[model samples]
Target: MGVLTGKTALVTGASRGIGRGVAERLGRDGPRIAVHYGSDKTAAKETVAAIEAAGGSAFAIGVRLGMPGDADRLWEEFDRHADGLDILVHNAGIGTSRPFAEIGEEEFDRLFAVNVKAPFFLTRLGAERLRDGGRVVNISSGLARAAAMPQLIAYAMTKAALDVFTRDLSKELGPRGITVNSVAPGIVDTDVNAAWLRASEEAWQEAAALAALGRVGTPADIADVVAFLVSEDGRWVTGHWLDATGGSLT
Candidate 1:
């Protein structure tokens, strides 16, 4: 049996990209994964199928975030499947590519609503159902600490807020032996960045050059980091922002 054979993990936005990677990785450890998707039911099912094909257990849960009662709605759906949670991976987030000056109020609010508020409230509610010694891993971005792209100012701000939440929540959940941390990645080659990143050879090369490793990061890279964090090996580590950035921040 794997290390997490009997555990239950909820990975938000598991339909695609980094979130899907995390879900699949954790599922491989034998946990019963709740594959959360915003609106893509088909993609969510595919994620579940992939996990099952790997000899893992998983089910899809769909709920649109950034709304008034998103967290509550999500938990309600989750309640139908499991009674408790052992791991909570808050990976669902939206990004804004608009420059600071061009971003409108609605756009900024929407970003915060989906990226920050959703996770904030979701964690608050999930904590009650989370077992002692459970894990809470928040997917953060390197932009939170560095001004990597001025155009993504609003997106960076949301991640910054998430990091703060990670730090503070760690203290709150420490007594229960629940570890909370933020894993910040840099320039990961996921579907989210595929459009601009794959536009030209020069574009891809420039992105790769930003990382000290001389190549762009992959979803698997981030997933491996998260797998370590949620495992028994990471029990003593908490309240930290892990840089899974391929040395980009260096």
Candidate 2:
């Protein structure tokens, strides 16, 4: 039997990248999965199908992560698909690399809405249905503590805010037996990083150099850490970031 057998998990932005990888890994333990997507309907369906083919229970739902009323619609679909919630993964986020001086108010709002506000409210919604001893893993970035890179101020700010949420909420949820934590990934090779990956050999090599592992990260790398964090072995871990960063922050 899977470690998570009979559990229900909701993974936002699960249509692709690290989220997709985590969803697939968790499905190995026989948990029902709600794969939430923003614009990639086909990709989301494909991910769900893959899970089902692997003998796991899974389905896809759509919502614009940063839009008004999106959270309500997402929660409603989640209710229909899941019997109850045990694990909640806030994996949906957007990244921008514009100059700080050029960042308009609208851009800032949009970035925070998706990267911060959506996850905050989702955590609230999940906490209501989350069983005692449930798990919440907020996907953050290594950038939270890393030396600043170009065009990532607002994005990093949003993730940095999540660290606080994880730390503070761990204390609040301790009595309930629920564990809250964040996973900060470094230079993960996802479509979101495709532009950088394909930018030039030098750029890719530089990313690799930053990692002690000497390579940019794959979705599976981050997923493996997440799987551990939400598993029985992770019982003693909470209110901390497992730092899936390949030691880049070091």
Candidate 3:
């Protein structure tokens, strides 16, 4: 049996990218995975299929976050599949590529709504369903700690807020043995970054050089870190911000 054979994990935005990676990894570890998606039901189905094909079980749930009553809708759907949660990976988020001066109010508000607010209320409302000794991980960005991408100023702010949430929530959930942490990645080569990162050799190499490891990160790299964090080996770790950036911030 796998380490997490009886556990249930909810990975938000698991339809693609890092979220999908985490879902698949956790599912392999033997958890029943709830693959949550925003609107891409087709993609979500594929994610579930991939997990099942890999000898893991998973189901897909659709709920657009960052809206009023969104958290309520999400949990309601989750209730249809599982009784409780052992892992919560908050990976759903939106970003703005415009510079700070060009970022409009709506864009800023939307960033906070999806990236910061959604997870905040989701955890608060899902507390009852979150089992004692559960794990919570927020997928953060290296931009939250560095000014490497000033164009994503608003987006960086949202991640910074999420890190703060992780720190404080760890304390609040400590009594129940729940661990909360922020996993910050840098220049991961996911679909989201494929267009730009693959545009040219120079673009790719420049991104790779940012990390001391001299290679661009992949979804699997981030996923492995998350797997460690949610496992029994990570029991004593809580309220920490781990740089899964391959030494990019060094």
Candidate 4:
């Protein structure tokens, strides 16, 4: 039997990239999944098809984060799709390459709305409805800690805020037999990042040099960690910032 058998999971931002990877991997464990996307209907449907083909359960749902009553709409989708939730992965986020000085109010507001605000509200709503001993996994980035790129200041800021939320939410949720934690990844190779990875080998090598593993990370790399955290085996872990960064911080 799989680790998360008979459970339900809701993964936001499952249209592509790391979020899609996580949802696909977790479906192997036999949990009914509600895959949420902003607007990529086709991508979301493809995810659903893949899951069903593999004999796993999944459904596509959509919501525009930062909209009024977004929480209500999100919960409605979950309720209509699944009876209850056992795991919630807050993986929806956006980041730009704009420098801090060049960052505009709209950009900051947009990122925060998705990266920070939506997660917070979703967690609040999810916690109340989640079964006892539920798990909440928030996808953070190593950039929150080592956000050295000048062009990534705003993105890093949102992640840093997410870290704080992860910690505080864990404390509040712990007493309810629920666990909350964050997973930070460094440079995972995925379609969304193909442009960057397609660059010069020298540039790639420089980036890889920072990783103790001497290579770049893959979507599966981060997904595996998230799957473990959402499983029964991860019960004792909570309020942690687990690094799936190939020991980049080590």
Candidate 4 lDDT over residue span 1-250, tens digit each: 7778799999999989898999999999999888899999999999988888888999999997876688789999888877789999999888798897898998889999889989998888777789989999999999999738889988988999999998998889898889989999998787767777768887788778889999989888999999888887899999999988998887
Q: Rank the candidates by lDDT, best first.
A: 1, 3, 2, 4
Candidate 1 local lDDT, 1-250, one digit each (tens): 9899999999999999999999999999999999999999999999999999999999999999999999999999999999999999999999988998899999999999999999999999888999999999999999999866789999999999999999999999999999999999999998999998999999999999989999999989999999999999999999999999999999
Segments of candidate 3 deviating more than 4 angstroms: none
Q: How close is every model to the real structure, measured as TM-score?
A: 0.99, 0.97, 0.99, 0.96
Residue pairs with backbone atoms closer than 3 Å in model 3 (clashes)? none
Runs of candidate 2 exceeding 4 Å displacement: none
lDDT for 22 in candidate 3 is 94
lDDT of each: 0.96, 0.89, 0.95, 0.89
> lDDT at 192 for candidate 2?
86
Candidate 1: stretches off by over 4 Å: none
CA RMSD of all predictions: 0.7, 1.1, 0.7, 1.2
lDDT of 2 by residue, 1-250 (tens): 8889888898999999999999998888888999999999999998899899998999898988888877788888888877578888989999888868788899999999999899888877667888998999999998899997658898899999988999998998889988999999999889988997879999999989999989999988988888888888998899997788898977
